[model samples]
Target: MSEIPSTDEALANLSMPLLDAMMTQRAIRRVKPDPVDDAIVVKCIELALRAPTGSNGQNWEFIVVKDQRVKDQLGKRYRQPWSIYGALGRRQAANDASMLKILKAVEWQVEHFSEIPVLVIPCLRGGTRVPYVPTPFVGETSYFGSIYPSVQNLLLAARAMGLGASLITMPLWNVTSARKILGLPLSVTPICVVPLGWPRGRYGPTTRKPVQEVVHLDQYGNRGLTP
Candidate 1:
Protein backbone atom coordinates (compact mmCIF):
# COMPACT_ATOMS: atom_id res chain seq x y z
CA MET A 1 0.00 0.00 0.00
CA SER A 2 1.52 3.34 -1.08
CA GLU A 3 -0.49 5.48 1.33
CA ILE A 4 -1.59 5.26 4.94
CA PRO A 5 -4.62 3.03 4.97
CA SER A 6 -7.94 4.24 6.42
CA THR A 7 -9.24 2.58 9.60
CA ASP A 8 -12.07 0.92 7.75
CA GLU A 9 -9.76 -0.12 4.95
CA ALA A 10 -7.29 -1.57 7.42
CA LEU A 11 -9.99 -3.45 9.32
CA ALA A 12 -11.29 -4.93 6.11
CA ASN A 13 -7.77 -5.97 5.20
CA LEU A 14 -7.51 -8.18 8.28
CA SER A 15 -9.55 -10.88 6.62
CA MET A 16 -6.49 -11.94 4.63
CA PRO A 17 -6.09 -15.71 4.65
CA LEU A 18 -3.98 -17.11 7.49
CA LEU A 19 -1.59 -18.96 5.21
CA ASP A 20 -1.21 -15.93 2.98
CA ALA A 21 -0.38 -13.71 5.92
CA MET A 22 2.08 -16.24 7.34
CA MET A 23 3.84 -16.77 4.02
CA THR A 24 4.47 -13.07 3.40
CA GLN A 25 5.09 -11.85 6.94
CA ARG A 26 8.80 -11.03 6.87
CA ALA A 27 10.37 -8.57 9.30
CA ILE A 28 9.67 -5.14 7.78
CA ARG A 29 12.28 -2.85 9.23
CA ARG A 30 12.02 -0.11 6.61
CA VAL A 31 8.89 1.98 7.04
CA LYS A 32 7.56 5.45 6.43
CA PRO A 33 7.16 7.94 9.29
CA ASP A 34 3.41 8.33 8.94
CA PRO A 35 0.81 8.22 11.68
CA VAL A 36 -0.99 4.89 11.95
CA ASP A 37 -4.60 4.75 13.12
CA ASP A 38 -5.15 4.03 16.81
CA ALA A 39 -8.16 1.86 16.01
CA ILE A 40 -6.00 -0.38 13.83
CA VAL A 41 -3.37 -0.74 16.51
CA VAL A 42 -6.00 -1.63 19.10
CA LYS A 43 -7.57 -4.20 16.80
CA CYS A 44 -4.22 -5.89 16.30
CA ILE A 45 -3.73 -6.11 20.07
CA GLU A 46 -7.29 -7.33 20.43
CA LEU A 47 -6.58 -10.20 18.03
CA ALA A 48 -3.36 -10.82 19.98
CA LEU A 49 -5.56 -11.40 23.03
CA ARG A 50 -6.74 -14.63 21.40
CA ALA A 51 -3.37 -16.33 21.67
CA PRO A 52 -3.00 -18.78 24.58
CA THR A 53 -0.75 -17.95 27.47
CA GLY A 54 0.98 -20.29 29.86
CA SER A 55 -1.43 -21.44 32.63
CA ASN A 56 -3.95 -19.00 31.16
CA GLY A 57 -2.15 -16.36 33.13
CA GLN A 58 -2.78 -13.82 30.35
CA ASN A 59 -0.45 -11.51 32.18
CA TRP A 60 0.47 -9.61 29.05
CA GLU A 61 0.65 -5.85 28.64
CA PHE A 62 1.19 -3.88 25.44
CA ILE A 63 2.73 -0.44 25.67
CA VAL A 64 2.15 1.57 22.51
CA VAL A 65 4.92 4.16 22.30
CA LYS A 66 4.64 7.11 19.91
CA ASP A 67 6.36 9.87 21.82
CA GLN A 68 9.52 11.00 20.04
CA ARG A 69 11.42 11.52 23.29
CA VAL A 70 10.76 7.95 24.36
CA LYS A 71 11.67 6.65 20.92
CA ASP A 72 14.86 8.72 20.99
CA GLN A 73 15.81 7.12 24.29
CA LEU A 74 15.19 3.66 22.91
CA GLY A 75 16.97 4.64 19.72
CA LYS A 76 20.02 5.75 21.69
CA ARG A 77 20.05 2.42 23.49
CA TYR A 78 19.66 0.63 20.17
CA ARG A 79 22.62 2.43 18.62
CA GLN A 80 24.85 1.67 21.61
CA PRO A 81 24.78 -2.08 20.96
CA TRP A 82 24.38 -1.87 17.21
CA SER A 83 27.65 0.10 16.92
CA ILE A 84 29.57 -3.00 18.04
CA TYR A 85 27.30 -5.79 16.74
CA GLY A 86 26.57 -4.04 13.47
CA ALA A 87 30.25 -3.82 12.69
CA LEU A 88 30.73 -7.48 13.51
CA GLY A 89 27.72 -8.43 11.43
CA ARG A 90 28.99 -6.43 8.47
CA ARG A 91 32.35 -8.22 8.55
CA GLN A 92 30.73 -11.64 8.93
CA ALA A 93 28.26 -10.98 6.13
CA ALA A 94 30.81 -9.38 3.79
CA ASN A 95 30.69 -12.36 1.47
CA ASP A 96 26.99 -13.14 1.97
CA ALA A 97 24.54 -11.20 -0.25
CA SER A 98 21.34 -12.18 1.56
CA MET A 99 22.81 -11.45 4.97
CA LEU A 100 24.18 -8.17 3.74
CA LYS A 101 20.69 -7.19 2.62
CA ILE A 102 19.31 -7.81 6.07
CA LEU A 103 22.19 -5.96 7.69
CA LYS A 104 21.55 -2.94 5.45
CA ALA A 105 17.89 -2.94 6.40
CA VAL A 106 18.79 -3.10 10.09
CA GLU A 107 21.21 -0.25 9.62
CA TRP A 108 18.39 1.86 8.19
CA GLN A 109 16.17 1.06 11.16
CA VAL A 110 18.84 2.00 13.65
CA GLU A 111 19.55 5.28 11.90
CA HIS A 112 15.87 6.26 11.61
CA PHE A 113 14.62 4.71 14.82
CA SER A 114 13.05 7.86 16.19
CA GLU A 115 11.04 8.44 13.05
CA ILE A 116 9.17 5.16 13.07
CA PRO A 117 5.53 5.83 13.85
CA VAL A 118 4.67 3.34 16.56
CA LEU A 119 6.42 0.90 18.84
CA VAL A 120 4.57 -1.86 20.64
CA ILE A 121 6.37 -3.12 23.69
CA PRO A 122 5.09 -6.48 24.76
CA CYS A 123 5.56 -7.01 28.47
CA LEU A 124 4.83 -9.61 31.08
CA ARG A 125 3.64 -8.81 34.59
CA GLY A 126 5.00 -10.93 37.46
CA GLY A 127 8.37 -12.50 38.10
CA THR A 128 9.58 -16.07 37.86
CA ARG A 129 12.24 -15.41 40.48
CA VAL A 130 11.68 -14.29 44.04
CA PRO A 131 14.38 -12.45 45.90
CA TYR A 132 17.09 -14.93 47.01
CA VAL A 133 15.39 -17.75 45.12
CA PRO A 134 16.63 -19.35 41.90
CA THR A 135 14.10 -19.80 39.15
CA PRO A 136 13.99 -23.31 37.66
CA PHE A 137 14.53 -23.89 33.92
CA VAL A 138 10.82 -24.41 33.35
CA GLY A 139 9.99 -21.31 35.31
CA GLU A 140 12.24 -19.22 33.08
CA THR A 141 10.85 -20.70 29.89
CA SER A 142 7.22 -20.41 30.96
CA TYR A 143 7.71 -16.80 32.00
CA PHE A 144 9.20 -15.56 28.72
CA GLY A 145 7.20 -18.00 26.60
CA SER A 146 3.92 -16.47 27.75
CA ILE A 147 4.22 -13.29 25.66
CA TYR A 148 5.74 -14.51 22.38
CA PRO A 149 2.60 -16.15 21.03
CA SER A 150 0.76 -12.88 21.36
CA VAL A 151 3.66 -11.13 19.70
CA GLN A 152 3.32 -13.51 16.77
CA ASN A 153 -0.37 -12.73 16.57
CA LEU A 154 0.39 -9.01 16.61
CA LEU A 155 2.93 -9.43 13.82
CA LEU A 156 0.50 -11.40 11.67
CA ALA A 157 -2.19 -8.79 12.24
CA ALA A 158 0.20 -6.05 11.17
CA ARG A 159 1.00 -7.99 8.03
CA ALA A 160 -2.66 -8.44 7.21
CA MET A 161 -3.20 -4.73 7.65
CA GLY A 162 -0.24 -3.96 5.34
CA LEU A 163 1.59 -2.23 8.14
CA GLY A 164 5.33 -2.68 8.18
CA ALA A 165 6.57 -4.14 11.43
CA SER A 166 9.67 -5.78 12.87
CA LEU A 167 10.39 -7.48 16.19
CA ILE A 168 13.48 -6.14 17.94
CA THR A 169 15.06 -6.53 21.38
CA MET A 170 18.37 -4.66 21.15
CA PRO A 171 16.60 -1.39 21.95
CA LEU A 172 15.78 -2.89 25.31
CA TRP A 173 19.26 -4.28 25.92
CA ASN A 174 19.45 -2.41 29.23
CA VAL A 175 16.30 -3.54 30.98
CA THR A 176 16.67 -1.01 33.76
CA SER A 177 17.05 1.87 31.31
CA ALA A 178 14.19 0.59 29.18
CA ARG A 179 11.94 0.31 32.21
CA LYS A 180 12.87 3.80 33.27
CA ILE A 181 12.32 5.20 29.80
CA LEU A 182 8.91 3.56 29.47
CA GLY A 183 8.01 4.20 33.09
CA LEU A 184 7.47 0.49 33.61
CA PRO A 185 7.26 -0.86 37.12
CA LEU A 186 9.45 -3.71 38.37
CA SER A 187 6.65 -6.21 38.04
CA VAL A 188 6.39 -5.69 34.28
CA THR A 189 9.21 -7.10 32.15
CA PRO A 190 9.34 -5.84 28.60
CA ILE A 191 9.88 -8.76 26.25
CA CYS A 192 10.57 -7.08 22.90
CA VAL A 193 9.64 -4.07 20.79
CA VAL A 194 7.62 -4.27 17.60
CA PRO A 195 8.03 -1.08 15.58
CA LEU A 196 5.10 -0.44 13.28
CA GLY A 197 4.52 1.92 10.33
CA TRP A 198 3.50 1.89 6.71
CA PRO A 199 6.01 0.03 4.58
CA ARG A 200 8.66 1.78 2.53
CA GLY A 201 8.95 -1.55 0.80
CA ARG A 202 6.45 -4.20 -0.21
CA TYR A 203 5.72 -7.55 1.44
CA GLY A 204 6.20 -10.67 -0.61
CA PRO A 205 7.06 -14.33 -0.14
CA THR A 206 10.10 -14.95 2.01
CA THR A 207 12.90 -17.40 1.34
CA ARG A 208 13.40 -20.27 3.74
CA LYS A 209 14.90 -23.75 3.83
CA PRO A 210 12.62 -26.58 2.77
CA VAL A 211 10.45 -28.20 5.43
CA GLN A 212 12.17 -31.58 5.17
CA GLU A 213 15.56 -30.10 6.00
CA VAL A 214 14.49 -28.84 9.41
CA VAL A 215 11.78 -31.32 10.36
CA HIS A 216 12.99 -34.40 12.21
CA LEU A 217 10.77 -37.45 12.16
CA ASP A 218 10.54 -39.09 15.60
CA GLN A 219 14.15 -38.83 16.73
CA TYR A 220 16.52 -35.88 16.89
CA GLY A 221 18.72 -37.15 14.06
CA ASN A 222 15.92 -38.51 11.88
CA ARG A 223 15.58 -36.05 9.01
CA GLY A 224 12.88 -37.81 7.01
CA LEU A 225 9.42 -39.18 7.83
CA THR A 226 10.51 -42.74 7.09
CA PRO A 227 12.95 -43.05 9.91
Candidate 2:
Protein backbone atom coordinates (compact mmCIF):
# COMPACT_ATOMS: atom_id res chain seq x y z
CA MET A 1 0.00 0.00 0.00
CA SER A 2 2.91 2.35 0.67
CA GLU A 3 4.05 1.83 -2.90
CA ILE A 4 0.63 2.82 -4.18
CA PRO A 5 0.29 6.49 -4.97
CA SER A 6 -1.00 9.10 -2.53
CA THR A 7 -2.25 12.65 -2.34
CA ASP A 8 -0.89 15.23 0.12
CA GLU A 9 -3.98 14.54 2.21
CA ALA A 10 -3.22 10.83 2.18
CA LEU A 11 0.40 11.48 3.15
CA ALA A 12 -0.61 13.70 6.08
CA ASN A 13 -3.14 11.00 7.05
CA LEU A 14 -0.27 8.80 8.24
CA SER A 15 -0.75 10.39 11.67
CA MET A 16 -4.54 10.36 11.75
CA PRO A 17 -6.40 8.10 14.19
CA LEU A 18 -8.68 6.45 11.65
CA LEU A 19 -7.79 5.57 8.09
CA ASP A 20 -7.86 9.11 6.75
CA ALA A 21 -8.72 7.88 3.27
CA MET A 22 -11.75 6.00 4.55
CA MET A 23 -12.80 8.68 7.03
CA THR A 24 -12.94 11.30 4.29
CA GLN A 25 -14.11 9.18 1.38
CA ARG A 26 -16.84 10.95 -0.56
CA ALA A 27 -18.96 9.88 -3.50
CA ILE A 28 -17.55 12.41 -5.96
CA ARG A 29 -19.71 13.01 -9.03
CA ARG A 30 -18.63 16.44 -10.20
CA VAL A 31 -15.05 16.37 -11.45
CA LYS A 32 -12.55 18.31 -13.52
CA PRO A 33 -11.60 17.21 -17.04
CA ASP A 34 -7.95 16.50 -16.26
CA PRO A 35 -6.67 13.28 -17.79
CA VAL A 36 -5.91 10.41 -15.42
CA ASP A 37 -2.58 8.70 -16.07
CA ASP A 38 -2.92 5.04 -17.03
CA ALA A 39 -0.47 3.95 -14.35
CA ILE A 40 -2.61 5.53 -11.66
CA VAL A 41 -5.59 3.53 -12.79
CA VAL A 42 -3.54 0.34 -12.58
CA LYS A 43 -2.39 1.23 -9.10
CA CYS A 44 -5.98 1.69 -8.02
CA ILE A 45 -6.81 -1.71 -9.45
CA GLU A 46 -3.96 -3.26 -7.52
CA LEU A 47 -5.44 -2.00 -4.27
CA ALA A 48 -8.86 -3.19 -5.36
CA LEU A 49 -7.50 -6.71 -5.87
CA ARG A 50 -6.82 -6.89 -2.14
CA ALA A 51 -10.54 -7.37 -1.49
CA PRO A 52 -11.81 -10.93 -1.04
CA THR A 53 -13.86 -12.45 -3.79
CA GLY A 54 -16.28 -15.37 -3.53
CA SER A 55 -14.57 -18.78 -3.38
CA ASN A 56 -11.15 -17.12 -3.85
CA GLY A 57 -11.92 -16.76 -7.52
CA GLN A 58 -10.70 -13.52 -9.11
CA ASN A 59 -12.93 -13.65 -12.15
CA TRP A 60 -13.37 -9.94 -12.46
CA GLU A 61 -12.26 -7.23 -14.84
CA PHE A 62 -12.15 -3.43 -14.93
CA ILE A 63 -12.72 -1.98 -18.39
CA VAL A 64 -11.15 1.48 -18.39
CA VAL A 65 -12.56 3.81 -20.99
CA LYS A 66 -11.44 7.23 -22.22
CA ASP A 67 -12.47 7.55 -25.82
CA GLN A 68 -14.85 10.47 -26.09
CA ARG A 69 -17.03 8.84 -28.71
CA VAL A 70 -17.43 5.65 -26.66
CA LYS A 71 -18.08 7.58 -23.47
CA ASP A 72 -20.77 9.52 -25.26
CA GLN A 73 -22.49 6.28 -26.19
CA LEU A 74 -22.32 4.89 -22.65
CA GLY A 75 -23.40 8.16 -21.10
CA LYS A 76 -26.38 8.29 -23.43
CA ARG A 77 -27.47 4.85 -22.22
CA TYR A 78 -26.84 5.86 -18.58
CA ARG A 79 -29.24 8.80 -18.78
CA GLN A 80 -32.43 6.77 -19.38
CA PRO A 81 -32.25 5.11 -15.99
CA TRP A 82 -31.26 8.35 -14.31
CA SER A 83 -34.41 9.98 -15.62
CA ILE A 84 -36.61 7.07 -14.51
CA TYR A 85 -35.07 6.80 -11.05
CA GLY A 86 -34.88 10.57 -10.65
CA ALA A 87 -38.61 10.82 -11.24
CA LEU A 88 -39.26 8.08 -8.66
CA GLY A 89 -37.01 9.83 -6.16
CA ARG A 90 -38.73 13.16 -6.76
CA ARG A 91 -42.11 11.53 -6.10
CA GLN A 92 -40.98 9.59 -3.02
CA ALA A 93 -38.92 12.39 -1.48
CA ALA A 94 -41.18 15.26 -2.49
CA ASN A 95 -41.61 16.50 1.04
CA ASP A 96 -37.89 16.33 1.84
CA ALA A 97 -35.63 19.04 0.48
CA SER A 98 -32.47 17.12 1.31
CA MET A 99 -33.56 14.13 -0.75
CA LEU A 100 -34.48 16.53 -3.56
CA LYS A 101 -30.95 17.93 -3.39
CA ILE A 102 -29.53 14.45 -3.91
CA LEU A 103 -31.76 13.96 -6.95
CA LYS A 104 -30.46 17.22 -8.43
CA ALA A 105 -26.88 16.14 -7.85
CA VAL A 106 -27.61 12.86 -9.56
CA GLU A 107 -29.15 14.77 -12.45
CA TRP A 108 -25.98 16.86 -12.78
CA GLN A 109 -23.90 13.68 -12.73
CA VAL A 110 -25.91 12.02 -15.50
CA GLU A 111 -25.76 15.14 -17.62
CA HIS A 112 -21.97 15.47 -17.37
CA PHE A 113 -21.05 11.84 -16.80
CA SER A 114 -19.21 11.35 -20.06
CA GLU A 115 -17.20 14.49 -19.48
CA ILE A 116 -15.33 12.85 -16.63
CA PRO A 117 -11.80 11.83 -17.58
CA VAL A 118 -12.18 8.10 -17.18
CA LEU A 119 -15.05 5.62 -17.11
CA VAL A 120 -14.33 2.27 -15.51
CA ILE A 121 -16.86 -0.50 -15.99
CA PRO A 122 -16.38 -3.10 -13.30
CA CYS A 123 -17.21 -6.54 -14.62
CA LEU A 124 -17.76 -10.11 -13.48
CA ARG A 125 -17.11 -13.02 -15.78
CA GLY A 126 -20.28 -15.03 -16.04
CA GLY A 127 -20.75 -18.85 -16.33
CA THR A 128 -18.28 -21.54 -15.27
CA ARG A 129 -14.83 -21.15 -13.66
CA VAL A 130 -13.43 -24.43 -15.01
CA PRO A 131 -11.99 -26.70 -12.26
CA TYR A 132 -12.99 -24.25 -9.59
CA VAL A 133 -16.37 -25.40 -8.33
CA PRO A 134 -18.11 -22.16 -7.47
CA THR A 135 -20.66 -21.39 -4.82
CA PRO A 136 -24.10 -22.78 -5.54
CA PHE A 137 -26.22 -20.73 -7.88
CA VAL A 138 -28.05 -18.03 -5.95
CA GLY A 139 -30.29 -15.13 -6.77
CA GLU A 140 -28.81 -12.10 -8.56
CA THR A 141 -28.34 -10.34 -5.25
CA SER A 142 -26.33 -13.23 -3.85
CA TYR A 143 -24.01 -13.34 -6.85
CA PHE A 144 -22.88 -9.71 -6.59
CA GLY A 145 -20.98 -10.42 -3.35
CA SER A 146 -17.85 -11.17 -5.39
CA ILE A 147 -17.45 -7.90 -7.23
CA TYR A 148 -18.72 -5.06 -5.04
CA PRO A 149 -16.21 -5.60 -2.25
CA SER A 150 -13.48 -4.75 -4.73
CA VAL A 151 -15.58 -1.90 -6.01
CA GLN A 152 -15.35 -0.38 -2.52
CA ASN A 153 -11.61 -0.86 -2.57
CA LEU A 154 -11.31 0.78 -5.97
CA LEU A 155 -13.24 3.80 -4.72
CA LEU A 156 -10.98 4.22 -1.69
CA ALA A 157 -7.83 3.71 -3.72
CA ALA A 158 -8.94 6.37 -6.16
CA ARG A 159 -9.63 8.73 -3.28
CA ALA A 160 -6.26 8.03 -1.72
CA MET A 161 -4.63 8.93 -5.03
CA GLY A 162 -6.59 12.20 -5.15
CA LEU A 163 -8.97 11.14 -7.87
CA GLY A 164 -12.71 11.64 -7.68
CA ALA A 165 -14.90 8.68 -8.50
CA SER A 166 -18.48 7.50 -8.06
CA LEU A 167 -20.26 4.23 -8.53
CA ILE A 168 -22.94 4.60 -11.18
CA THR A 169 -24.96 1.41 -11.51
CA MET A 170 -27.77 3.06 -13.41
CA PRO A 171 -26.01 2.25 -16.69
CA LEU A 172 -25.87 -1.41 -15.75
CA TRP A 173 -29.61 -1.40 -15.16
CA ASN A 174 -29.71 -1.73 -18.93
CA VAL A 175 -26.93 -4.29 -19.08
CA THR A 176 -27.61 -5.59 -22.56
CA SER A 177 -27.32 -2.20 -24.20
CA ALA A 178 -24.35 -1.22 -22.08
CA ARG A 179 -22.47 -4.38 -22.93
CA LYS A 180 -23.17 -3.81 -26.57
CA ILE A 181 -21.82 -0.27 -26.37
CA LEU A 182 -18.70 -1.41 -24.55
CA GLY A 183 -18.15 -4.25 -27.05
CA LEU A 184 -18.14 -6.74 -24.21
CA PRO A 185 -18.63 -10.43 -24.80
CA LEU A 186 -21.98 -11.70 -23.59
CA SER A 187 -20.24 -13.68 -20.83
CA VAL A 188 -18.67 -10.53 -19.46
CA THR A 189 -21.24 -8.89 -17.22
CA PRO A 190 -20.91 -5.13 -16.75
CA ILE A 191 -21.78 -4.67 -13.10
CA CYS A 192 -21.32 -0.92 -12.76
CA VAL A 193 -20.07 2.16 -14.60
CA VAL A 194 -17.75 4.34 -12.51
CA PRO A 195 -16.78 7.82 -13.64
CA LEU A 196 -13.36 8.89 -12.38
CA GLY A 197 -11.56 12.24 -12.39
CA TRP A 198 -9.97 14.98 -10.31
CA PRO A 199 -12.77 16.43 -8.16
CA ARG A 200 -14.06 19.92 -8.80
CA GLY A 201 -14.19 20.56 -5.04
CA ARG A 202 -12.25 19.53 -1.97
CA TYR A 203 -12.47 16.03 -0.52
CA GLY A 204 -14.15 15.72 2.88
CA PRO A 205 -15.89 13.30 5.22
CA THR A 206 -19.24 11.92 4.20
CA THR A 207 -22.37 12.62 6.23
CA ARG A 208 -23.91 9.28 7.12
CA LYS A 209 -26.22 7.74 9.69
CA PRO A 210 -24.32 6.82 12.85
CA VAL A 211 -23.05 3.25 13.07
CA GLN A 212 -25.11 2.48 16.20
CA GLU A 213 -28.24 3.33 14.28
CA VAL A 214 -27.46 0.64 11.71
CA VAL A 215 -25.48 -2.04 13.53
CA HIS A 216 -27.03 -4.77 15.73
CA LEU A 217 -24.93 -6.69 18.21
CA ASP A 218 -25.89 -10.14 19.54
CA GLN A 219 -29.57 -9.30 19.12
CA TYR A 220 -31.75 -7.30 16.77
CA GLY A 221 -31.97 -3.55 17.56
CA ASN A 222 -29.13 -3.84 20.07
CA ARG A 223 -26.49 -1.13 19.53
CA GLY A 224 -23.10 -2.06 20.93
CA LEU A 225 -20.54 0.47 19.72
CA THR A 226 -20.59 4.12 20.81
CA PRO A 227 -19.70 6.49 18.01
TM-score of each: 0.97, 0.83
lDDT of 2 by residue, 117-158 (tens): 898888998754445666556735555888899999888887
Badly placed stretches (over 4 Å) of model 1 are: none
- 111 Cα displacement, candidate 1 (Å): 0.4
* lDDT winner: 1
- Model 1: ten consecutive residues of lowest lDDT: 218-227
Please provide, for model 1 over 1-227, each residue's C-alpha lDDT reduced to its tens digit, 9 standing for 90 to 100: 47777889999999999999999999999999989989989998999999999999999999999999999999999999999999999999999999999999999999999999999999999989988988899999999889999999999999999999999999999999999999999999999999999999899999998777788888887876742
- Top of the candidates by TM-score: 1
Q: Give the TM-score of candidate 1.
A: 0.97
Scored by lDDT, model 1 comes in at 0.95
